[model samples]
Target: MTKPKALLIDVTKCIGCMACYYACKEANKLPETEKVEEDLSATNYTVVKETDGVFYRKLCMHCNEPTCASVCPVKAFEKTPEGPVIYHDKKCIGCRYCIQACPFDVPAYEWKSNKPLVKKCTMCAQRQKEGKITACAEACPTGATYFGDREELLAEARKRIQENPGQYINHIYGEKEVGGTSVLIISSIPFEKFGFRADLIEKPLSDLTWEIMSKIPNYVVVSGVFLYGIYWIINRRMELSEYNKSKNRDSSEDKN
Candidate 1:
């Protein structure tokens, strides 16, 4: 099996150049606007944000067990073995379940389009298949975003932290959050300072979703039987009322 690829982002190296952002728009053939976008949206797959003179990139996490894939009833979202979470437009029912279910709030709906679909980063799955790096990683001039095997990148991240104890925080973002993600980050500052969710559980969100989904069949069976019982009782009462009415009419006729 092909090893899963991942992106290792070093926050200290990022200069907020927005090269990756522009490359993503160009690679995806998204519309060009007059101003640079600072937030994720249907049109913008990636964004660069600055806080206290520090730069960081925001995009889809491409989780190993994606909550979007788990919550999508129509199987619109797929977590590929190649370390990308891809969306199928044709399979999407526009239920917006994925948007609500995603813990990272990465998925965006095309509200302006008449035929809208959920949009997010695919982690350049096609490029990986072609043995090419992601567009964002390619465009990164500062080497802030490095792409390679997930395990190897993880080791490299640990090595960086170990070599420079005072330069980086002890924690590695995305290493265990939501059961690990393809995108990893190491930073001098805490992740929560960059608006990253620090309180996320290490457990995969999909596990909880499956737990609820497993009980659905039993709930449906019980509900069906209960509704049928009510219907039967109502029908029996109607039949008895009609029989009583007929008997009274016959008795009145005999008395006359």
Candidate 2:
């Protein structure tokens, strides 16, 4: 099996350069923007933001067990063994369930298109298959974004925090959030300061989603039966009312 890959982002090393953002746009062939986008969108899969002079990148977390994959009724979202959460456009029903289910709010819908599809960073799955690093990591001149094996990246993150105690916060974001993700981050400032969610549970959200999804078939069956029973009762009552009316008219004719 291919060892899962990951990206380790050191927030301190980021230089507020939008190299990763531009490289992603070019690699994905998205439309070029004159100004850097402030948030993720259908066209902009990734964005870099500066908060209080600290630069940080925002993109898909690519959870090991993706909630997007679990909530997609058509199975449009897939968590590949290579560490990418890939979306299949053809399989997508445009239900936008993945958008609602994603905890990170990474998935973006092409709301302007007549035939819209959800979009997000793929973690450069094709580049990984070709034994090349992701476009973002490759374009990072400061080495702010480093890509490698998931386990190795985690070790590296811990080492950085240990060696430079004053430079890092000693917590690796994405390490245990939603059951660990392919992308990790270490920073001097707390992640909450960067708008990263601090309330995320360590358990995989897909596990909870499955618990509900497993009962969906039974729910549908029961609901169908209930609705049919109501229909049958209404139809039977209408038929009996017509029959009684006809019988009364016949009795009136015989008396006359």
- Output the number of the TM-score-best candidate: 1
Candidate 2 Cα errors over 4 Å, as ranges = 215-256
For candidate 2, the per-residue lDDT at 48 reads 93
What TM-score should be assigned to candidate 2?
Answer: 0.84
Estimate, for each residue in 146-232, the C-alpha lDDT of model 2 and write its tens digit: 999999999999999999999999899999999999999999999999999999999998888678879999999999999999999
> Candidate 1 — which pairs collide?
none
Off by over 4 Å in 1: 218-256
Instruction: Indicate the residue-level lDDT of 45 in model 1.
Output: 94
For candidate 1, lDDT tens digit of each residue in 124-234?
888888888999999999999999999999999999999999999999899999999999999999998899999999999988767888999999999999999999999
Q: Extract clashing residue pairs from model 2.
A: none
Q: On a 0 to 1 TM-score scale, where does candidate 1 land against the true structure? A: 0.85
For every candidate in turn, the CA RMSD to the true structure comes to 3.8, 4.8
